[model samples]
Target: MLHIGNAQIPTCGGLTRRSFLQVGAAGLAGLNLPDFLSMKAAGAVDESKAEVKNCIMLFLVGSPGHLDTWDLKPNAPADVRGPFKPIKTKAPGIDICEHLPLMAKLADKYSLIRSLFHTSSAVHGSGHQWMMTGHGFNNGDPHPHAGSVIARVFGQKSALPPSIILPGKVGAVGDNLGERAQTAAYLGSAYNPFFLGADPAKSDFKIANLSPQAGQTEFRINSRRKLLAELDAIQQQVENASTVAHDTAYQRAFSLITAPETKKAFDLSEEKDSVRDRYGRNTFGASCLLSRRLIERGVRFVTINHFDTVFSIACWDMHADGGSLNNTVQDYERHLLPQFDQAYSALLTDLDERGLLKETVVATLSEMGRTPKINGKGGRDHYPPCWTNFLAGGNIKGGQVIGASDKNGAVPHDYPIDPPRVLATIYQGMGVDLDQVMMPGPGSRPIRLIDAEPIPELF
Candidate 1:
């Protein structure tokens, strides 16, 4: 069993089954593969309809520098154009970073929103809140992560948790801001997204949350469950709202512990070597492949945080300062670009070949973009004024660039779209009707999925 703070979970041997139950109560939606098809057979969630049901969100934490990656400006002055040259894609007049060669080949598979912006503090957590929850509220008044919201609204379809975040949740981003926004704020802890604490790329990888204790036998687990049932019986003597909640939690615990596929979902060795190579046998790349796996098992919203921390490791936030957070253009060409291209392209191609692409919506999002012009450090500064994000699969239109940035790759010259629209568009693609399907919010008020409407063009 791996020790996580106070809990010594029996994760290694039988933890996946237990962890699945421990996730939450009555929260399910989004199913994958055998489970999804089984549900379709059982008349649960339909697969024949062209509804966008599953999501694989690639959260580019620490944010990618817009100038170096998506919004390349080769014609600008030497400093403005930066070091890398822009390469044309299959789509005419649409150029991306030179290092994204694989992505260039798959340009027709996704649509780029070249003008996504948000008005939030330049701090990473603030932008995370804005993009994650569609509102940057504080801990005292937290908002649900987009995945958590989907969980609360739709409900689970299989034993796997409805919402999941791979490689763990976001942590310390300079300040002690609301890092737990990945939770269901006023919606209660029962709706939080299930977090995968271990790195998928590691050779000895195991889902930390799914590992069982060293000496924890299945019989012992079953015995403990019975004891909890009896203790809950004692608590129910004076039954109240909280007691009822405890009962539901207990049931969820047992259900997960008893599920077999929950164990299968975390078993990467079950995949072929050729498949693993296609996803690029790296941390971020493997995580992307796992996201597809979880979705295939009935997970609703699967968020793959490309990197948990922006420091030390090669990430997209090309600060270029020779320090902890430094990420130069060299890193982009050799590490970040190729890693992302290989992984993302593999995900799209694999999903399409497996016949899952048309039923799932895959999105690439970031907190915000970097400056339009180059910085003194030979990189770009934070720029909330303009950036780029993309959406594909499901009901979204492919082979299109809906918005445009100015000549310098600065602010939007036309059709200035913000982050909220991205979330709204995702909902629309996922078969969610914002005008209907109201979710209970604070004070038991029925709140719309999001107040904003989905971008019509994404359809």
Candidate 2:
């Protein structure tokens, strides 16, 4: 009988009741992409120039250990060094985990920020808020995800939604501490990121929201629009001002459900088998390929959440606890690393082939990293003290890494950059002057789109 906003949450459950309250309120601002697309169709938003625009984010759900992934330690002790070895990358001096061979080959195209840290709460939600929204928060005040912010500022492009979260939205991590950064907070429900509820990796892959029911035709749709128009006339008399907004919302819903181009953007069948194989036929891999399709159709932002749940899946959290969450180095080698390597390299190659590389930025990020010191279970615990995240393409400078971590990959030794700088760099890469573009706050106050400055070296 515990209450979280309007939703009832289990009070006696493992997580706190307060967390459930946050969860209940989280989905309240959920957005509809088709509705946004329909609005675009009605000329509600601008689609002026065919500017080079696109972004694909690979969000490693469970934070990967920096020492194991981007920053390897061969000289350190056996326990500290862990299992993976460093392999020389195409970037010459740069070396990444051996398991990521495909990524190593394309290392010249991407840069790894070895020195990155934030002293936020050492929880998964903390990093999710940080990497996803570019700010750290202890208070439960929700913030907009970078993609949603992009949507609020740039609006929709063609029939596709401006911001999209692939496969599914972020759910309960280990903690109920709300990951508010993913929501479009004060921007309202109109600007929330579109959540693709189904997994792209499944053989029966389909965008549930984009799918139309059998026998539903244009004639039926047009009739529904007429009916809605009549209803709008009635509502107009009851609430004059609010009627316009509600009508706009209704039209948006129709456009998405009836649009042909929007459906194609979500259809994987349009892609070649070889292309699918190149991206790796797995969940994260297929999602990357789908992102490319969406970008081709003018989707402004696409995020591929690596995995939805960290409990049963063999995720990046290598806390080999010998239980359901027990993910060892073997899991990284056998599945995660290779899959990411293939998908990421394929996305880079594909985007470059289509000449979208210069206009699109690909960011590989995580919540945080594992501890510098190995735990008793031969796995590393959560460590936010230091880690690594990287950006490529768009206006980002590749080939050379910007920062460095100390020995054993413990802390930032030079140019300690936080998460906001990374978000700022993305905005800059997208040709948005962080100083120029601003969004409205709760009280209709103009708030700076991002409070931080872009990493100069990234450009």
Candidate 3:
């Protein structure tokens, strides 16, 4: 018998126990196998009554103003209405910002939720935690992201991870904000989303984590796999739940490193020049394109963050302070709106043309809506009292508004929606039964996936 970590391997059939143990022990310490195993678990996807097979979430890092974008107030005063005018869409009675002309043309493909409000603090992080995870971090009991919970419930669809966040992770927005909101939390590390640390728009783009280090070769990789296989064989003889879970994780890591399809999935070059051009060559555009590729390749969920930080960058957080975080209305006109309109419209049209729209739900989410009234610096401040987000494709009814803001776009007028309801709608759209499906909670006890019910009107 030979020992490797907490498991034992049998060597009597071939080499001596001492030599086998020596070789196994030599390189195992550097493998970092436990962390990989802790990141994923195997479960069957229950698609018996699912309306959609996948989802692509475009997270607008900074919140957009309802009055300026979806819920326009044309009759209001200059400061209130700002400068942008609303344009008619294909859907009658629906109008959006003139800056979003492309989106207006496709209005019938999605629905807007204008009455979304939250009671939490009006901070960027609070909204991120609420919108991303469906629940705010309570005490130290952080909830897993909606995507992570989905990954846990449905499991992986293929060699690709179940849930993936493109471009990079959100960071440096505010104090005590970025912690654990994007992580797996109590669901354990296995359900955490795989973040593409590098920007895909770069010409020399490559996933650093996926590529092998210098001097590492396929031959050496295979040899390590062989050794792990022997160790796994021994463990199976005395298999327990934990051991089985570890095996699944190790197998996922092995596949990711060696599979040609894995590399092909991340390759933007495979896309035609025309298609890439349509998506634009910028970071957000490339990310949107890559998201489609990933969904096509079997990833269950893909999230594209429009901007990772609001500091010194042109983002949706239009606080026209004329300082470091000086994003203004001009930013929306020249950069933000155009960039979003191009990339987002391209994604919707491309998905529809490929016949993916029916099986994939595209959602545009943000933390909070900007203040209804413009600030002193000619920008809108954070407003959690009211905002707007939207959904399209799958079973979501399009060309209609689900809720509304007041005359001033300050509060919900009717059909008021909250963050949890939005998340519940997404879960239902993805064919998940919130009532029947449960995930492992704080202890190993099974708990309802979400406390809220799906928005019935979406169906």
Candidate 4:
């Protein structure tokens, strides 16, 4: 019998499956394998069937108004229609905001879902929970982020974490509860999205978590690993499953810190200045560019939070309050729309040129949409009735709008959609059979990943 930490294997021969699956301290701390890897090794998952291998989720933290952006009601009252004029695109009958000219040209590369709505509270936190996790958990049993679910199910392909979120996690957006929605709640800490704490656009951008301690060298790290191994052996016997999951999380962190390839994946300096300029060289743009690099390097899931917060910044939350959260139409016309147009269009072009777009789905999501009627303060407020989000690349069929908003853009006038259906569609596009695959729910029970079916129109 061969005992490797908590994983005990019966040794029969040198070529036995037990020996092949042996996870020693070095394997756990130095090699690239999460809990999902063990499941794959045991034939629990077949990765070969996944047609869409990767996903790049660009989460627009503050929701953009459906009327002002994708679903323009040109014939409606001026108050409901807003200021932006619609422009034609390559895809016939599809016209987006004039501010998104670059995106307009590439309309054939993406599809819009203009009638998405949720009946949850209109608060930003509730919307975040719904769109990101596919379940509204105001009752406190929060669900995991979609990327975290992917990390747990798909496993890692390289030293890079299976899921990576660039810039940082979602921060304060009206309610404090929205921030926790970005976490892996029931899926455990091991599958949490790897938050890139620093801005990649900065001149001195560095991944702090990937760097070793101030006084630590390779030899010192190795020495500590030996000591930690001795301690982990004793700790394993008494700790619960949560502790074991924490150890797996630590193993992932250790592998990332020691691996040279992982460091190179986060290095923006290697990219040409021209490419960086094409991505716009700002925080959001650079993050989008970095998402491509990470995806190119075998990251299964990459999330780029366009803005981490809505306070004291020019974000999508257009309250026009004349103070903090004072984003107006000017912000959209100047900074928000232009930057998104540049970064998003560049992402599509770069991915397609590199032949990655065919295998990687890029999803643009948000908390919720702004109010259909323009506010007295010349901005829009939070409205949970309807909004727009989109998906492109991968196996997604582009160049068409799936649903529609009413004449006033108040509610769904056509095919009404919700958050879970969107997530189910994304999962199906990733080649996951919703009927066959199930997640390990709370209390180790088998439960469906989502309760809804995929949007048939998407595929």
What are the lDDT figures for the candidates, one per model?
0.76, 0.77, 0.83, 0.83
Q: Write the per-residue lDDT of candidate 4 for residues 1-459, one digit (tens) a residue.
A: 432212333434444565455655437665434443334322223456666788999998888888888888899988889888999998999999999999999999999999899998888889888988899885677888998777766777777888899899888787865666778777778778899999999999998888987988999888877887788777766646575577667677778889888989989999999999999989999999999999988788899988888899999999999999899999999999999999999999999999999889899999889998898999999998999999998888899899888888889889999999988888777776676566667874546678899888777
Candidate 2 lDDT, tens digit per residue, 190-256? 5677789998879888777777677887889889899989987777666432343456557556767
The residue-by-residue lDDT of candidate 1 on 316-354, one tens digit each, is 777777787788888888888899999999999999998
Q: Provide C-alpha RMSD values for all models, in order.
A: 10.2, 10.7, 9.9, 6.4
Best by TM-score: 4
State model 2's lDDT: 0.77
Clashing pairs in 2: 4-21, 35-252
Query: Lowest-scoring 10 consecutive residues by lDDT in candidate 1?
Result: 1-10
* Lowest summed lDDT window (length 10), candidate 2: 2-11
lDDT of 3: 0.83
Candidate 3 per-residue C-alpha lDDT over 1-459 given as tens digits, one digit per residue, 9 for 90 to 100: 432211223433666666566547744854233332233256454455565878899999988888888999999888899989999999999999999999999999999999999989989999988899899887756888877887777778788888899899998787566467888777766677889899999999999988988888999989999999999988866634456555776777787889888999999999999999899889999999999999999888899989888898989989999986799889999998999999999999999999999888898999999988899989999999999999998777888899889988999999889899999998888877676566667764556677898889888
Q: How close is candidate 1 to the true structure, as a TM-score?
A: 0.86
As a TM-score, model 4 comes out at 0.90
Report the C-alpha displacement of residue 355, candidate 2, in angstroms.
0.4
